[model samples]
Target: MNAQELRDKTPDQLRDELANLKKEAFNLRFQQATGQLENPARLRSVRRDAARVKTILNEQAAKAAE
Candidate 1:
């Protein structure tokens, strides 16, 4: 949801969350393509959330490397 919350999660949990967000993003895209998407905003939010998870993951990896 938020970076702070995501920061608190273990890498495994973060990966799982990222996967779910990707799935939701794909479904949202499909719904939009079919003209069935009720909330277009959700797509944006999911994308951002996925990005946040990725950023956090990278940060963790970088920290470990250091």
Candidate 2:
């Protein structure tokens, strides 16, 4: 997803997306280890997406705390 798409998500939606991304990352890793993955780049993409969601979540939490 792009930055604008991420920005459009609410904190709750971001958290849900983060969870799904993490699950996908784990599955990708498993597939890679077993030589079943079709695209290694997908793992990297998922990781980055997860990070983006996490960063947004943290930013929201910090803003709320302030």
Candidate 3:
């Protein structure tokens, strides 16, 4: 998912996405550790996506606090 799409989602949806991405990241790490990872690039993308979700969440929280 892109940042634009992420910006459109509610906090709840973003939280869910972040959780899923984190789980995927963990699994990817496990796969890599065992040399079973087919797409190492996926790990990078998932990590970045999770960060993007976090950024959006922080923005929302900042707005709410105002």
Best by lDDT: 1
Model 2, runs deviating above 4 Å: none
Tens-digit lDDT track of model 1 for 1-66: 778999999999999999999999999999999999999999999999999999999999999999
> Considering lDDT, which of the candidate structures 1 and 3 is the better prediction for this target?
1
Best by TM-score: 1
lDDT of each: 0.97, 0.90, 0.96
Error of 3 at 4 (Å): 1.0
Order of candidate numbers by TM-score, starting with the best? 1, 3, 2
For all predictions, the C-alpha RMSD in Å is 0.4, 0.9, 0.5
By summed lDDT, which 10 consecutive residues of candidate 3 come out lowest?
Answer: 1-10
Error of 1 at 59 (Å): 0.2
Q: At residue 16, give the lDDT of candidate 3.
A: 96
For residues 1-66, what per-residue lDDT tens digits would candidate 2 score against the true structure? 987788888988998999899999999999999999999999999999898888888887898899
